[model samples]
Target: MVHGGFRVWSGSEPDFPRQAEQVRSLLGAPDNPALLPPQFVAAALTGIGGMLITRSRADALVDAAFALPTRDPSVILAVRHAANRPGATRLTLVARDRPGAPDGTLVDLPTDWKAQESVFATDSIAIGEPGSEHAKQARQLQGQIWQSPPDNLYPTWLYAPVCPASMSLVALHGDRVVGFLLGFQSQPDRDGTTVLESQVMGVDPDYRNRGIAVHLKHQQAIMAGMLGIDAIRWTADPLQAGSALLNFGRLGAFSRRFLPDYLPFRNELNRLPASRLRIEWTVAGEDPRTELSQHRLHLRESVVPGTTCPIANDGPMDLQITPGNPLIAIEIPSDWTALQQSDLATARAWRTNLDDLLLRCLGEGPDQYLITNAVIHRGRVFLLAEQATNNLLRLYS
Candidate 1:
């Protein structure tokens, strides 16, 4: 059993097939091969179990739709399990083009089709502000994930209350807390502008790759907008490829500052130096998805196709300095944790290489650069950075 009072249900939970079918029916999926969000498809097919969410639970997710004055009974939120991948489940919005026809086929609903907010209710998980009980669960989850010493642990209850209600988010699967994101308002800058500083986010081991983290960040952005905040700032380990992809690729955040040994203590799970990349996300500007797609296209056209810095099969990769170049692509291991476990020496060397490169390209003055987006091409992962004057970045600004 996992800590945090949450149970890790086995892949074969009670009434699994029936549960899957109910979700399919809710979406008007006459067949299992219907088109849906690709991210939802990839996650479900690769996960450990089929649709774990029940019909009533799925209905609760779209309960918001019922409140809309123009609510269409023909349109609703639903889920489907991948036919080939036994345990894969998908969640999305669908609508019947011909509501009155007996054989009306359901189609993918437009994301902007008169919806207030996209519900992130995959696998029956719900996101919201934590209450007293939920806070206790969140605290337990934090302890389980980080395993910090008593002195190092965050005082979740003592601190969370001080944050705006919407800023402290919790993810619940039924009555059990599966994930949480803690953030607080930062001190006003010289210009009197304040932003939300995300302190930490964690999801259950069994529940990752299910889009939980992405949903948490999206929900956080929504809440920040309501509070009139314009930006959100956070720091993450520079060596973690997943963090880089999510921060820069998916969310369109950019980093200009790299801090060495940002944290005095070391985490047992990942014992490397606690260097971090400070990232800033503009919440009130152009949509992140739109910006990311545009940025990738711009990079492909302007830069070499294989500009990804090479990674050594053994030992640390040799650093190649290209001073004065407008762009730099630095590659990090796709799975940093696995690399550390398998070969600590190689992992350390990779960090040393990154430390050297980041300090130079992302340093101060005219030579400084911004790490904009991370991408995977032909099985290689690369972090893309460029000078501020680049046309694409100028448009992003």
Candidate 2:
């Protein structure tokens, strides 16, 4: 597969390292390949020098003894590559932009140069309101990503008008609108505080995992704070572990409500039941990582042996509600996509079971539970929830 000018080849064999060596030879490795360090190729490896640099400069020949650029692209050969798992030997012929400096800052490259060469560099993306010039593109992007019927989409004019309570943020890559978030101020609550109800947000499939969505959300929160809104609320598919990680783990959001069949859709993206977890991200709140650590500490002190419920596909779910134990851990598939592809029936079962489980645990009143953190440990994804308290909401109020 080719990704941003980097050609990747993968294969599994009993002797994968030998295969990697043979592939490197076929790809024109020098007779005496130079022993290079992992830092040159932006990888972390242990125990002395092991990476074999077959070719340093692909376009032009450079002296083998000369000093190489600190983080330049090169034709790297492999044998038992540390990055890949066992039995899967991979080779990468990369022709992308050079790595950043040691201090974690991008080198000053021209805009055109970066646009033409960089793979995941998001500096070229401009985040702002989609004025009249790009409102149509933003609408089209949203429809394309969501795959919603034309009738279900918002009218183009709805995005053109300027409203104080509503804000539309779009991520622009060059002239193309690649990502967007549409939200409006919610009615004042009993506490007389308002929140921005972020109704919908999406990023281009080709430009994902590049921090576009995170940037858009951060910008939305900043804008909401400026408008005197203290929090932003949104709903997400609980089964989507990536979104769960971003919302609860990276974005400092918490969930206390679960909606079963939130959208009565059976589309390709939305599986049966279409359950969602209502997430509330405080515009100004303590770091969720710190809070999660504190929760773990509390759990470590108070958790019993039967507090965690390990979800299994083949059996019925019997959630254990241990009394006097405030913390509970629930497991979900770490790789939802893989699970769905391999066993869709199991995936659906997980959805229904998880819906019933969360609905009961996250219900209203004093016995309700709140999801404080989501974590991926040892290839398993888990949600850490604590029983609701009077002052629990104040953390992100």
Candidate 3:
């Protein structure tokens, strides 16, 4: 095995024939002299190093390493290698299969992958409607105390008073509530100048890849423009990929503060380490209308109700189209609170099964769909779809 990108030697180099015999025995290759070459042995060792270091290897190696019965072994191996790397911090990547390819499947590196950390995005906060199911889910997962007569349960209202006015939008999915833009109406230093603040944002364990949080923030920015918020400000965890991508790569939200564990509530509230990040958003010259439009369109397409297979019986589904083969969407809840507070072994077993099912469906065809917009209302999940060629597909509940 290679270590730190270098090969280790146990003793003097063994003769080619002897080593070749060992390789044949281990890998089940033929022992014929003509069947093996000295160069081939060298190449095999080099390939192993490449696989360990750069994680660049053939599909056959993936199959051999993972021993997967089905599914794309190459992609799976790549993800596994990336995920298992020592000292890895986060992993963020948009699903390659999303209708929007490279642009859509935005992935951050090791920082965002940690099971304990929660992410908040200022962008998501701007777009989410008050009192939506998405909002309720976010609130519940955030571990915030919920006050209720059971019927008068508006979680958003709980945070409304303390939440900044510039933060007209907020989004919560999975276990993290993200996309909070904070600002005040008047400031002594800059009179009449509006400020933008990204108060908090994150992805729940179960809701990472669906892009629900990102869509929420994009929508919020658009809403800010319309509402004449003028400016936006927020903070991020400097070590996170999603934060870097959104603040620097996309919106150009500049970092203004760098203190260790700046957000005290975050540290006291959760078990993970915290870092301070402050950003400012200048709404002027930023056109968020297009982003808002795309987000709404994608949100409509992705949202699905029900948490498991055989779509639950619930409210009206907007669209429903079955492909040539039966397509099913199973919801696996992996939020931080759920994982931290529940039976991990059982949850993992369920997750593995669900992932297997999803991969199977993906292999079916381009017609296969994974919808995230389905809302769970009254103990049922709702799904939406439209028909395809030669199939009477309409929105089914």
lDDT of 3: 0.34
**Per-residue CA lDDT of candidate 2, range 1-397, in tens?**
3332323322222343443344333433322222221111211111111122222237422211111211122312122222212222222222223111111222221112111121232579988766655666776776687665543444343243333324677788887888878764454556855666776788998889888988888888877777677778878887788888788777768898887886644544664567888888778755537664475446544543333533322222646554334666677677665666678898888887888778878844766788877776556666767778766665544
TM-score of 2: 0.61
Clashes of each: 4, 0, 57
lDDT of 2 at 158: 29
For candidate 1, lDDT tens digit of each residue in 1-397? 1212212222355643344344444543433223232222222211211123221233342210100000122332333333334233333433422111112223332222111222457778888776656766776787688775443444333223322212577788877879888765554445745566776788988898888888899888887887777678888887888888889877778888888766555665558887789888877744537755666667754654244333222225655654666677777788887888788898899888778778777844575678888877667677887776655455555
TM-score for each model? 0.64, 0.61, 0.33
| Clash list (residue pairs), candidate 2 | none
Alpha-carbon RMSD of each model: 19.5, 22.2, 21.5
Ranking by TM-score: 1, 2, 3
What local lDDT score does residue 76 receive in model 1, on the 0 to 100 scale? 28
TM-score result, candidate 3: 0.33
lDDT of each: 0.58, 0.55, 0.34
- After the best TM-score superposition of candidate 3, give how far the Cα of residue 297 lies from its true spot, in angstroms: 26
**Worst lDDT 10-window in candidate 1:** 62-71
